[model samples]
Target: MIPDLSHDRIDRLRDAFRAAGYDADGVVELLGPEAHVALGRGEPVPALRATTDAGPLGTLVRLFLLGQAEPQAAVEAALAPLPLTDAQAAGIVVADGDRLRAGLDVRPHGVGDDSWWVVSDLDSDLRGGRPVEPDHVLGVGHASLSLVRATSRRPVGSVLDLGTGCGVQALHASTHAQRITATDVSKRALALAEATFRLNEIDVELTEGEWFDPVRGRRFDMVVCNPPFVVGPPRTDFTYRDSGLAGDDASALVVRQLPAFLNEGGTGQLLASWVHREGEDWEDRVSRWLPPGAGVDAWFVQRDVADPALYVGTWLRDAGYDLRSPQGVQKAGEWLDWFEDNGVVGIGFGFVTLRRTDAARGEVVCEDLRHAFDDPLGPESDQWLRRVDWLRANASAEGLLAARLVTADSTVLEQVSEPGDEGWSPLVHRLHRTDGPGWQHEVDELGVRLLAGCRGALPLGELLELLAMGFGEDAEELTRAAVPVVRELVRHGMLVPAEWAGGAQ
Candidate 1:
C-alpha cells in the first residue's frame, strides 16, 4: 500500500527547521521526534526562533526529494581547497570560484564502502525525505521501471537515455535491448549511477555532455529523457532543477533533434515540460516542436499545467527561497520576464512518446496522438510476442486452423446458466462487447496449469494442446475457441502472422 502522506506537515516542519537555522545539503538533525511532538501536541519548539526569513536550506531538501540535481559530495570533496562553516552536524561546506566549502554536518562524519554521507549526525538537510536523496533518485524503483515498460513495445536493438540523471531508465532498458547509453551533465550524478550499476551488476555505457552535444550524430533504437522541465529561474543557489534556459525551449531543443538521432524503427520516450502562450493553443506549440517532414509518431500526455507566476513561486519554495526576500523577488521577477517575453502564460508538463519512421524503409508517420496514453486496454506486448513465436513454429494458416486446443483457468469459460441448470454453457464464436465478457469455453485444469510452466512463452493454442493431452477434451472445440483469441491478439498486433523483417509488417 502507498504511504499516507501530508505535504502540509512537511511544509510546516520545513519552515520550522529553517527558522531553527539549517543548511540545505541533506541536514535534518533538527527534525527528530521532539519536533514532531511539538507539532502533534500543538506545542511549539522553543529552539526555533520566530522569524520572517524564508528557509533556503530546508527548501533545498524538498527539491532533492522531487529528484532535482544536487552536488551531494562536491563541497565536502573540495574541503581542503575551501573554507568550511559549521552546519547541521559536521558543518556546511560550499565552493564558490573564490572559495570551495560551506555546509552543515548533522552528525559525526563517516564513509561506508567508498560511499560518502554525513553519518552519526542528524539529516535536517534531507528536508523530510531522508532515504530518497536526489543523487541516487533514479533507479528501477516502482515508478522508474513502470516508465520503462510503458514507453514503448520492446525487443529493441539499442536504446539511449539522455539526461540520464540516476541511470534508472538506462539500467532497465538493458533487459529489453542489446546495448544502452546514458548521458548527463553532472559527474556526481553520473558517479551515483555508476555505483548503482556496480551494485546491480548491470553494464551500461556512460558519457558526459550537455544534452546531445556528446552524441552528435548517433542513432538509437530508442531515446529516453527525463529533462529539467521546470520553467523558472533558479534560486540564488541553483543545482539540478534549473538548466538556465528560457521558457520550455530547453525541452524543445532536445526533442527537435530526435528525428536526426533515431535509427529506423526507433522510438524516443521523453518525460518533459513545455510552455503555453496566451494567444495559441498549448498542443499546437508542442506539435511544432517536431521538425518539419520528420514524420515521427508523437504521443504527449499533459498531466499538469500551471500559470507562470504560480509556477515561479512553487519552484522558489521548492528550492527553499522566500518570494518576499530580496533575492527571491528578483529571481521570481526574472522568470516572469522570461515567460512574458516568450509569450508564455502557463507551463505544460507531460511525457512525449515518439516513434520515428524507419527511414531505411522510406516510411513516415507525422501526426499527434490526442488519445490517452498509459491506460492499458489492448493485449500486452509480451502476449503479442508469444503469438509471434507460435507463428514461427506453425507457419501455415492450416497448421494453426487444424490444431487441437485446451483452456486454462485464467482462460475464463463464460456461459449463461439456464434457469434450472447448474454449470455454465460453453461459448463458441467470438463475441464482442465494450466491457468484454467474451464467451469462454470449459477450462482445462492442465491448460490453466501450464501457464506457470511455460514462463512467458507460447501463445494460447500451443499451451492448450499441453492441457488437451494432459486431460482428454474435444480438441477441435478447444481449437475453435483458441483461434478467436489468437486472431483478436493478432488484430491488436499482440501477435503477428509469420512475416516481415524491418517495418514491413
Candidate 2:
C-alpha cells in the first residue's frame, strides 16, 4: 500500500519520528555498534534480538527494519501524536488483529548533520527474506549513495532528478537548488517519493514519464540521475533496476539524449553501465555515445567491470534469486545466453558527468578509476572538468610551456629506492595524491625536478631551462622531453596552470 500524503498527518508523523528518535543515530544507539553494522549487511538477527524490548525506538525498529508486528498499544506509544488509526489510514502500517506491522520501509537516513526519513517498498531482506517485487521502489542503496557522493553541490537555479526512485537525490538537491523537479516512470515510486517529500517538508515538482519525456524542450541547470542502467536481456521482473531495454541500450539512450536537456554550462551527472564488446575499446565505445558536435564535455570513470557470469550472478542475487535454485539457474542461463548472442565481453559500471560547455569541439575522457576517494567528490569533479577544459584549450607544447604551472596541493612526492650491494639509488618516483580521487603517478627524475620547481613563480619553459642548465643538458632537448609529461600532469590535475592556481597573472 502506498502512503497517504495528508499535510496535517505528515506533520504529526514527522513530529512523532523526531520525538521518538527514529533516526540514524537513534537506530545505532538502540542497536549497539555490532548489531548496527550487522543490520546494514542484512543480518538482522542481532538487531532483532537487541530491539526485542517494546521501547518506542525498539518498537519502531522492529516494526520497520525487522518487519515485525507490534501491538497497537506499543505503536501508539511510539507515535503518540500520530495515532495508530492515522498511521493505518496513511497506509504506513497495516492492522493485524490488534497488532500493526509496517506496510513499507520507513527509516531515518542521514547525510552529514542533516537527517531525513525515507519511505519505500520493503526490500527482500525485510520481507520474509524473499525476492523483491516486480515494481519495487527502492530505498537508499549503494548506487544512490554513489550518485549523491559524485554529484556537484554548487548552488543552482534549477535541478532535475531523473528517475528519482523514492526521491533521495531530489531531497539532497533541495538543499542546494532553488527549484527541484523529480521525475520517474513508475507511479508507485513517485507516490513513495511524494510521501518522502511531504514527510520531510520539502517542495518538488513531480513529473511522470520515461527519461526526459516529461521535460521536453526544457532545460535545467543541473540534472542528476541514478537511472535503471542494469545491462541484461529484457525482463519484466524488476522496474527499479532493469529498464526493459535490450542489452545496454537503456544506458546508451540516456547518455545520447542528456545533452539536449542540459542548459548551457549545466551539468548532468549519472550512474550508468555500458557494454564492452569483444573487439572494441571500452573507452571508444563509451565516447561514441556522445555526438561529435554535442558541445558537452564528458568525464567518465569506470569503477567496476564484470564479465558475463559475474555480472549475471550479481544482478540475480541482487534481485534475490539464489543461483543454486532451479529458477535462478534458468534465469542466469538466459542472461548468459543473451550476453553470448550479443558478443558482450564485459559490462563496465561507472559515474558519468557531462557539462554543457561552449567549446566547439566536444571532449570525452574515459578512465578506469577503481579506487577509493575521500567523501564529497563534488568539488573535485568541478575542478577536474575545469582542468580538462584547460588542457584541451592548451593542447600544444608551446601553449602549455608558456603557461605558468604549480604542483597541486593534494600531491606529494615519494621516492622509492632498493637497497643494493653498491648503494641505495632511487628506483621509482611517485606523486601520491592525499585527496581528490587519490591518484598515484610514477614520474621520472626530470619530471620530479620540474614538479618540485613549479612553485607558481615561473613559466614551465623557464623551469625546464633552469633544470636543463643545472643538469648540463640541452635546453631544447629537455623541453621536448618534458612537454608531454607536463601535459599529462595537467590532464590528471597533478599540475595546475598559474591562472587556475590564482598565484600569477
| Candidate number achieving the greatest TM-score relative to the actual structure | 2
Which digits, one per residue and each the tens of the lDDT, describe model 1 over residues 58-150? 333322222122343432222222222322122233333443222322221111222222211112233332322233233222334445545
Candidates in order have lDDT scores of 0.50, 0.87
Best model per lDDT: 2
Compared with the true structure, the alpha-carbon lDDT of candidate 2 equals: 0.87
Given candidate 1, what's the lDDT at residue 156?
Answer: 84
RMSD after CA superposition, every candidate: 13.9, 2.3
What are the per-residue Cα lDDT tens digits for candidate 2 across 1-505?
4467577887888898888889988998889999999988879899999998748889999998888888888999898798777888878888778788987889899988878899898887666668988889999889899889999988999999999999999989988999999999998999989889998989999999988999999999999999899998886678899888888778788888988888999999999999989788989888888866779899898988999999989888888888999999999999899999999999999989999988887778888888876655677788877777788788888888889888988789999999999999899999987877777889889889889999888988899999999989999999988888887777777888876675311
Candidate 2: list runs displaced more than 4 Å. Answer: 1-3, 49-54, 95-98, 392-396, 499-505
